[model samples]
Target: MSIRHCYLQALALSTLLLFSGLSLALEKPIGPAVLRISGLVTQPNMLQQAVFDMQMLQALPQHSFTTQTPWYPEPVKFTGPLLRHVLAAAGSAGENITAIALNDYRTEIPFSDALKYELIVAILMNGQPMPVREKGPLFLVYPFDSQAELQAATFYNRSAWQLRALQIK
Candidate 1:
């Protein structure tokens, strides 16, 4: 096979996959689900809602940032996918989101916040998986250190720990 021929074949296959909607597929979670997103989402084969295991969240583009939070005494590095990326994967250009915690705490966040800030659904803290007692499994955190305005009461209140679900609207 000629190199040019192989290149042409590869391009054709990729174009076919893209047009067939294979490029937009989101697989069913194989591990235990850690989070659920519903209301206004358009995930493949699961329009209106999506379940995400730890690995599913990790599969998105990952980002990390260190910030001092009121919940902690020192600045700690938080690592996970950006909230915007998660929303994109769910096919939601959301306007409002209700973040639900494991203990039933709920907070309303404007979707614009995700677009404006480096908000993250944090899976790891300080290079280690956060324990439940330490506010883990999952946490929605803002990049407080990145901007002075983010180090405020409003952002802290929106930073829901033990985050379990996000209801987009």
Candidate 2:
């Protein structure tokens, strides 16, 4: 009725829409789910896990870099959302992440890696989408060439490929 009431109503509606959008972001994947994040998270939608389709991850801010790795003979381009952004989207609040690959190869990645290193949840390699056989739909990659400290077996083993799930602990 009054101007104050109208303003309050508009604010309420906007707040409702904002929360609705967040809920929609966690909706079941339209295509196959590329990754699942579970444990120590604020949001869990699918079977107590946040399941992400390729498009969902792609929607985040993309980061790309070319670097050499033990697996590759030459510098290769890796592209995907930053690990921190992905964790934030999933509402992950943990000190460490246990990355599990398709082959059941698992590695523990410190949460600090997201801050200390420009880690990427790599969706593409060498400008091409990685097939499951080639270590894709997802890979956790560190910029080994960018930082000398990351060029060791410890960091190499922590770079999980064919990443299927992440459990925060």
Candidate 3:
């Protein structure tokens, strides 16, 4: 990709996030709502939470990476929209985020991690949608193999699978 293309993409994203932060009204989910993001956000579809379905998540720009993770037997390709973009769409402002999994597991992650790393809310694993048994509808993943720092347990713990909700603070 050319520098000009990158510049244009950045410009478009900046304008979208900045101008729509306050006025973005999320539409009712067309499919089953899969994720809820609440707390410290400028825009919320519900009282304090913004719910999203698969279609909503897929609407954002998608990114993918193949990485070796502790849970997987081999390097697997994961794909989803960048976590930062999702937060930006929600008009989120926070120092931290609490990820809640389907089984009630939760973990705290610094907000800076999203900006600092190419973290993704993975909806696909190995180019296919993951089943709940395999860590499903959503997974907060870090590109562990991309950087030595990401290989640590701190980052691994942040890679919450079967993710259901996020509370930003």
Candidate 4:
């Protein structure tokens, strides 16, 4: 067999394996999907959308930070996976994200925010699970205390609560 033939065969096998792995990486949610990410995603598990159960989100690297918000009387500790990590799991490659809450309130968050700060999709506040009435099962919590500029109204608006879905743009 020629060396050229061997090289071509190896390349073909690697390409096939890569594509197979990508499909296998997407798993259906076992429990009710708490979060749904659609549009501009490479990996979609449920009806061509990326859906996550609470356990799935908890499996990712955890990030915690304390920050004061207008919604709360005092500084609260927020804990969950970083937004960028969640986006990566969805295979999202977009410039913007339209975060929609359960109440239908929506906000546009630049993708750069995820990259620039340790913005968390918070599942816990002050070491306790937050129910829907408390602004979660999920909340997009910015590290407001980390940067002075993040304390502004624009950033506050971006900190969406009761987050249900994200539409990548």
Best by TM-score: 3
Question: How well is each residue in 12-112 modelled by candidate 2, as lDDT tens digits?
Answer: 43454355343324556788888999986656668778889998888877899999989988899999988877776676656689999999999999877
In terms of lDDT, the best-performing candidate is: 3
lDDT to native, each model: 0.82, 0.82, 0.84, 0.84
Clashing pairs in 1: none
Clash totals for all candidate models: 0, 0, 0, 0
Estimate, for each residue in 21-123, the C-alpha lDDT of model 4 and write its tens digit.
4232657789898999998676788877999999888887788999999898899999998887777777765668899999999999987787688899999
Per-model TM against the reference: 0.84, 0.83, 0.86, 0.85
Judged by whole-model lDDT over C-alpha atoms, candidate 1 comes out at 0.82
Q: How high is the lDDT of residue 39 in model 1?
A: 82
**Alpha-carbon shift of residue 39 in model 1 (angstroms):** 0.3
Q: How accurate is candidate 2 locally (lDDT)?
A: 0.82
Clashing pairs in model 2, backbone N/Cα/C closer than 3 A: none
Question: By TM-score, highest first, what's the ranking?
Answer: 3, 4, 1, 2
Off by over 4 Å in 4: 1-24
Any runs in candidate 3 off by more than 4 Å, and if so which?
A: 1-24
Backbone clashes in candidate 4 total 0
